[model samples]
Target chain A: MSSDAATDIMDGTHSALRTHGYAELTMQDIADEAGLSKAALHYHFDCKHDLLLAFLDRLLARFRERISDVGGDDAADRLLSLVETVLLPPTDGEPHEFRTALLEIEAQAPYDEAYRSRLERFDEVLTEEVRSILEDGVAEGTFCDDVDPAEAASFVVTYVRGARTENVAVGTALGDSLEAFRGYVERALLAPAATSVTDGGDADDGAGDEVDGE
Target chain B: MSSDAATDIMDGTHSALRTHGYAELTMQDIADEAGLSKAALHYHFDCKHDLLLAFLDRLLARFRERISDVGGDDAADRLLSLVETVLLPPTDGEPHEFRTALLEIEAQAPYDEAYRSRLERFDEVLTEEVRSILEDGVAEGTFCDDVDPAEAASFVVTYVRGARTENVAVGTALGDSLEAFRGYVERALLAPAATSVTDGGDADDGAGDEVDGE
Candidate 1:
């Protein structure tokens, strides 16, 4: 099949998934969304599982494209933008519903090798992008010298992933989470005071005075 | 049913879940593990869903008990213990398999009100403990004065949740993540130098000097 044709099928899959989610989706729904016959879809993909895997790959490609074009003033801005791109929901469908469907798909990773691999690719690519930006930030003096790019990138990506799940599972506001993350980046990441990690290995002195609950 | 009997049933559910996972689990498995007939199991819970919900409730209770007992020298240590309690997988059955089943169940939160409620309780309790610890740390001067306990608690909980998901989905090393988190807490939360947040919202000046990628 032509590349454009395949893209169309992938878009169709996205629409169908948004509507029916993973549990109830079918090949027919994908075909109907693509405006192709079921036989036509079969001609391209053997089964729903195969089609879903390909869809994930295409989604990753789209993500890569988006990242390359996400212009920003500094590496810090770019890193945040890269995170927002994945953390926030797309406007195409009900945010909660789409996340629900995505979570359902993600839950299959441990049991599904294809799904696991695709999801890992997504994580790997995002982590790399964040790590690169972090390195840039450190070099430009926008971030602290001691910042470990790869480690921080992993943390950010993992936090973003969990935030999405929180948005769906517990209705935590994504905007609040994003703002919280931004604040963290500002205080903890951007220009942190050079400090050592010496805790003295000593317990607290029980100065427990002036302790008021927030 | 008696409290001890119910506890036994919950224990059975846990074992059954670990052995068979959420997808393949059945009432029969739970009953067998509990050393009761399926009919006896049904006498307490009408169906598998109800029993599973009860199981989640019991898990949270167990977590609370564990948290209460996890004594630490100071609030910071307490906070770390609190986070670690949930971040690390239980030493039961196969860790990956158990996490997979748990992820599958968490994915059902959107469509399953009972699951969502139970899971929310988990988040609420963890966040509360973290916030309480942050407050104590601040009062004791172990943490920064400007640290917003609630906001930071939310971030920490979200990161921990994501870290657990990463552990299951991508096989991320939980130990490495915990160490990284410790680093973050030390640098960001623990007595950070009193500073202002004045970035001026200005774009990059492009000094473009001494730029070395990490």
Candidate 2:
């Protein structure tokens, strides 16, 4: 089978997994859900784990595209862009449910080394993107110099994951959650120097809202 | 069974559950682990879910006790105390694994409504505590007036849960992982006023190393 065929099947399985969960997902189920024969399902992917990993691959590909969307000339703009993307509508299709199913799978990942590694790799890529943005921001004076790039990167990614987890668990869209979360991002991400150096200038500056883009 | 006898059996079952996860645990496993017969296990609990709920109840009771330890104090102290308690070692024969196991159960709780309600209530109570503390601080001129106690409170609890999830997935102690987490909490829970006014004056100054106390 062609790669496109394999991708299509993986996408279908990802969607089904999100809606039905891992426990309920089976080879036969994916075959039926994807409109393919059981033998054809086996022809492309070796097993369910392989198919799940493919879904994660797709998720990473899409997120990387968003990371590349940080077209702003400054670090603050880039960081804000990343946050805005996270706060925007979750990608339409199986990807959203794929995330939910992934969270469920994450619960079992401790017992499964392969799943854990996949998650760790995904986190590493995200952290690198965030760290790069922060590093550039520091160089440009757009971000506080004293900020720990590594920790800030982790914080941004972790906060996004937490926000996404809450959304998926509760079925709320990111737009609905943007205002409440903007306050959180302000405290968690903005430079303290930027806030305090100007004598309450930061309070009314609306810097947070501008980046949040709501 | 007599009340005292039932209590003893319940306690034994609870301990056993803590040591083994829900999926790996069976009535026979519980009975054997708890030094009871299959018949005795059935006499006390109808099914695994019943036993699981009882175990969750005991765990919730312990968290309540922990929450009470830092209560009625100043908002910062209360919140910081709660963070320390969560990050510190367990004081009363409570193994860290037990809490990890409880979190593991929380991951599964989404599939079951009754369990999900219990988990939601758990989050609601802690979030409320944080909100009340933030409100008090805002009134007392400690936290900024613009602080949204509800949202801030949610961030605190969610941040802690996310941290705990990391620890469990990595099989690391909270202490081992805490160095990385310090920055995240600072951003998530610290008020802007507190951060700007403090100026690293006392970052860890009086934040005692004692995590849990007898």
Query: Residue-pair clashes per candidate, as listed?
Result: 0, 0
Q: By summed lDDT, which 10 consecutive residues of candidate 1 chain A come out lowest? A: A194-203
lDDT over C-alpha atoms for residue A24 of model 2: 68
Q: Which residue runs of candidate 2 sit more than 4 Å off their true CA positions?
A: A71-74, A87-90, A94-97, A167-178, A191-214, B1-19, B71-74, B92-100, B170-173, B176-214
lDDT of 1 by residue, B158-213 (tens): 99878878877777888777877876776678663311112212214422111111
Q: Whole-model Cα lDDT per candidate?
A: 0.76, 0.64
Task: Tell how far residue B8 is off in model 1, in angstroms.
Answer: 3.7
Clashing residue pairs in candidate 2, if any?
none
Candidate 2 per-residue C-alpha lDDT over B72-184 given as tens digits, one digit per residue, 9 for 90 to 100: 23465566667667667457555655555565566566577767767766677777777888788778655667677887777666556656665555444566435444564
Q: What docking grade applies to model 1? A: medium
What lDDT would candidate 1 get against the real structure? 0.76
Q: Could you tell me the fnat of model 2?
A: 0.25
User: What tens digits encode model 1's per-residue C-alpha lDDT throughout A1-214?
Assistant: 9987797899899889888888789999999999899999999999999999998887888878776666555666666777776776344434677677778888777778888888899888888888899998788766788889988888888889889888877879888888888867866776532111122122144221111101
**Local error of candidate 2 at residue A202 (angstroms):** 7.1
